[model samples]
Target: RGSLDLNLETLSGNLIAQNHSFHVLEKISFELPRVELCPEVLKRAKSFVLADPIFGKPGPIDVLIGNSLFPQLLTNERHSLGANMPSALGTIFGYVIAGTAPCLSTAPRASNLAISLLSTTDTDLHSSLQRFWVQEELPVYDKKSEGELACDKLFETSHTRDSQGRYVVRLPFVDNLAYAKLGTSRPIAAHRFESVERRIHARNSSPLKALYIDFMDEYEALGHMKKPPHLNLSAPHYFLPHHGVVKEHSSTTKLRVVFDASSKTSSGLSLNDVLLTGPKLQNNICDILLHFRLKNLVFSCDIRQMYRQIKIHPDDQRFQLILWRGQPSLPLSTYQLTTVTYGMNCSPYLAIKTLQQLAQDEGSNFPQAAHILKHHSYVDDLIAGASTEAEALELQQQLIELLRLGGFELRKWVSNCPKLLQQLPASHQEPPVFLQPSSDPMFSILGIHWSPVTDCFKYNLNFTSDAPTKRKVLSLIARIYDPCGFLS
Candidate 1:
């Protein structure tokens, strides 16, 4: 939180954190007043230097030290890394490995790295990254942390295998949410709900109502909610109902119905305030992008409603409650989200973890699809290309089936292969939605526009009446997304 030492480079020409655009920065050095080894032990240290802040702002890492120092700091620390480390520093992280799993390197020696992190990037730029995880396996994960324990609660007894040996998460169905604990139904929570209710009534717009209907329909269809019971024994948790802002999709309006998890009950704790934002999941965006080249027969597809597929554990469903009514004239009804919800802090972890778990569960039967599912996809979007059309088609079929085992569906398929696109029904070949004008004839592959018919990437610009100054032009130019670095 203190002011940062702005000088960030050593004249010796080592890259502290340089991109290829990295010209030799002005040499510099600085000593930290005290790099805390622990609250008890302090090491006055010399760090090479932080680089110029991207966009003139400090990065997540305030200081840059050599990798050699990592082995020493971790080896000498008597307590688990989570303890003793000041909460202000947040936490240390490495990178994503298999299916939405973020890993930290804990071992001191290079030999142990392979065992601990279990994955590596495939190209030249990540060579240094490969070194970060080279050390040995982590010490046992028995380190007690509120975050760790919360994650532990997920794996406790509720997960099992189906007859097909697919891992299935057993979700709890409840007439209502339980709130004896967490002070969920207390007056303060009710007040928060009242505030949301007031806003919806005040707006009273048709588009807003459409969003509400879409949300309630989906909620009921999933069996994650239902009509209020006439009578019930347990005091189900009462979560404040809130309508998400309306988003215009094509011509249709959609509402993201969510419970105000951050709303406090009389207990003064919002659901988010109490929950841990579990371990980071999902591979690096760059890692995912790097693999999506137009090698030969490339294709991409999105996992429909990625988060809704993972069913929350029944024990945990009590935490996801909402209040709502189908008609404004009707009384507000209580409903609980039986499945994982979008707004909850833990949703990403649960969803990604569930995906990774599916890959692990079925990898043996479908190796190629599993590999793409694990390392190649960015969350639900899968980008992969094969050396031949036949190979790509085979990969596509296997991918669809593999995901289906976990109650997931892969749709919105697009490909450079005409045969592949033409062979599929009209639904699969539906023109790229909202990506470009129909006249432009471009298909979007993870934000890059390409001509699937021509098998080449296309770049186009739509001018919005205003001409820009030189600096503005440069800024706009940089906004374009090109992951292959073909321009470079």
Candidate 2:
């Protein structure tokens, strides 16, 4: 139906309904064979069923049809719904999806109605809303500007060194902040950190230790982390009211490092509770993919350590502190992360803001590559295509160089174009079949396991030692993150 909501309540997961209208959600339509009801049957159905309100009298109704009854109205004779609906509605039917008259918004309690003729034959419906909002503009509505006058992200920075001679960034408190009270003093989650730290040390699993080592290596290399003195620091250096947790990852045996920004500091508030989850800055994943497929020659690459590449204000480093120890015998040492760390509330905003800033600043020099950077990238991942192999190769080089201009590294280049792949280092190419995860070639494209070689998606199912349960089955199914609904 035209008004089916994704969250509509149903006894079976598979939904089948004649009519549903949810004002809280939205609607779409698809094409279908046009069918019409006889006057007598249509009048009876309308008098009995279609007379009810749609989501509580959503203004005057233009058209009404009880889908369940409409199916029974069709006869041997077939009627086609073609491009002549405009003329038919004007001369024959009473109400239409459009109006030749001006917008009703000029009068109080006045609103416009939009309707779509849907096909009952196809369940997988996709539609375009571009032509639906073409009614005359009666008045202007004010909207917010792109560049906010006073943004939460705006900050002042200061650089200082801890006793170990390691630099610590300090973001001074905002003067006019009232909505979210981020205490000047960060509350330490001492017990939580100690408990987790003790578990990691006591369990002493090889994978856990290895993950930590890898974390430290990258932490040090990026200069995001620094070792503080064994003793406590003086006033003004905030510990950032945060902690760490190791999360389960399916791909590799080793877990991933995650900082718990919600950890209560010495103050009652956690960083996440106070920080703003900035505007969604990147394009939709579907839009990005659609843009990539526009050209014949296609290739994709990702920025290495996407968040780590963007440096935060030096003054803000003190808020991202964590405790660490190289050896079991050694005491837990204090360390401050200087750059954008994973699991922070504003990490996505900072990362995306940086990427957009780079594109906006250097876009003129590399127009094509810059356009892709501005429109196609989802966070750090880049997907772009060109009509010709030579154009594709040029885009790749220009993309890498343009990103490099801002000290960003682009690696793991894969291409449908053989010429472009040849230009990249062998290390950047796809792994051999034998080394792949399975016999099926399911390489990750924007987090979905897709076959670039075969131009389709790849799925893997495996056995588990865990006992069968409803929750477990649901969890496994939920892990199947196919946002585009390609499986359908």
Question: What are the per-residue Cα lDDT tens digits for candidate 1 across 221-320?
Answer: 8776654444242554546546576656422225676655666554444566556566666665556655666367888888877777666555556556
- Per-residue lDDT tens digits for candidate 2, residues 162-262, read 44322232232333352135444422344445544555666556666667667776777768688744334453344442333465533332454677776
Tell how far residue 149 is off in model 1, in angstroms: 8.4
Error of 2 at 388 (Å): 1.3
| TM-scores of the models, in the order given | 0.60, 0.58
Which sections of candidate 1 miss by over 4 Å? 1-158, 161-181, 185-204, 227-240, 249-253, 428-430, 433-439, 459-468, 482-488
Question: How many clashes show up per model?
Answer: 10, 15
Q: Which ten residues in a row have the lowest lDDT in candidate 1?
A: 94-103
Report every candidate's CA lDDT: 0.55, 0.54
Residue pairs in collision within model 1: 9-28, 11-27, 100-282, 109-135, 112-135, 112-136, 113-135, 172-314, 177-236, 177-237
Score residue 475 of candidate 2 by CA lDDT. Answer: 46
Residue 272 of model 1, lDDT score: 64
